[model samples]
Target: MTPRSIDEITARADEFADMFEGYDPKPGDLDAPVPPVMAVKLAAWRRDVAERELADAVRAAREQRLSWREVGNAIGTSGEAARQRYGATA
Candidate 1:
């Protein structure tokens, strides 16, 4: 599927927000878990956020002259793996 461009999303943002804000769910629905597709999307969004945050941290750590082994240990990986993953970023 093609991703929506930023402008397309921006244009629809207010409409989406209005629809979301207008919801009037039944009392029982208040305690319900998210739908399966929403759950999957939420998980993907979390992972993307985590990846960006990790890259930012790794960039900072490299700027502080931290060793790849140290960074790897902090992130639960081997030094070589860390180097290969983020070497160019730093």
Candidate 2:
């Protein structure tokens, strides 16, 4: 599959959410007609897009000389924790 943009992934996720709305009363839903392979493809696409976006954000944050405190706050972690996790890599 081709690389997908964040917007495309978000849009497809939204579509999947819509598809499951008020699904059914049965326990299995296994008889449902959705393509099982589509779920796998979407999950892989999401992981790729998320990683790219995270790398870009880390690069931008480092370029701005923003503190690990700020980044960690945004990520719900301690500054030291954030640095240990991503600083050198960033």
Candidate 3:
């Protein structure tokens, strides 16, 4: 894998953050009318993007020789949990 520059990493992070902007469904809005089917599709698409980004990050961390424990710590889970979730996919 080619090493990413700090700029590249920052850009990707920004893009990931942008993915969640204005698209999250609010629980308090349950009384509001149901959203269009397109909203569901968009939410699924966002989930897909997030999953791919997570796999890529896991792969990158592994390449950088970071231990599963470290990766898990960063992600707020146990090493085994992190490995089980992303190891094969990464």
Top candidate on TM-score is 1
Q: In model 3, which regions exceed 4 Å deviation?
A: 1-34
Candidate 2 local lDDT, 1-90, one digit each (tens): 999999999999999998889566687667666577997898899999987787678668978998889888877889898788777778
Cα displacement (Å) at residue 28, model 2: 22
Q: How well does each candidate superpose onto the true structure, as a TM-score? A: 0.67, 0.50, 0.58
- Model 1: per-residue lDDT, tens digit, 1-90? 799999989879978998889988988887888999999999999999999999999999999999999999999999999999999988
The Cα RMSD in angstroms, rounded to one decimal, for candidate 3 relative to the true structure is: 16.3
lDDT of 3 at 47: 97
**Clash pairs of candidate 3?**
none
Candidate 3 global TM-score = 0.58
Name the lDDT of candidate 2: 0.83
Which lDDT value does model 2 have at 20?
Answer: 89
Let me know the TM-score candidate 1 reaches against the reference structure. 0.67
Weakest ten-residue segment in model 1 by summed lDDT: 23-32
lDDT (CA) per prediction: 0.94, 0.83, 0.89
Candidate 3 structure quality by residue, lDDT tens digits, 16-64: 8898684677787767755789689888999999989988999999999
Clashes of each: 0, 0, 0
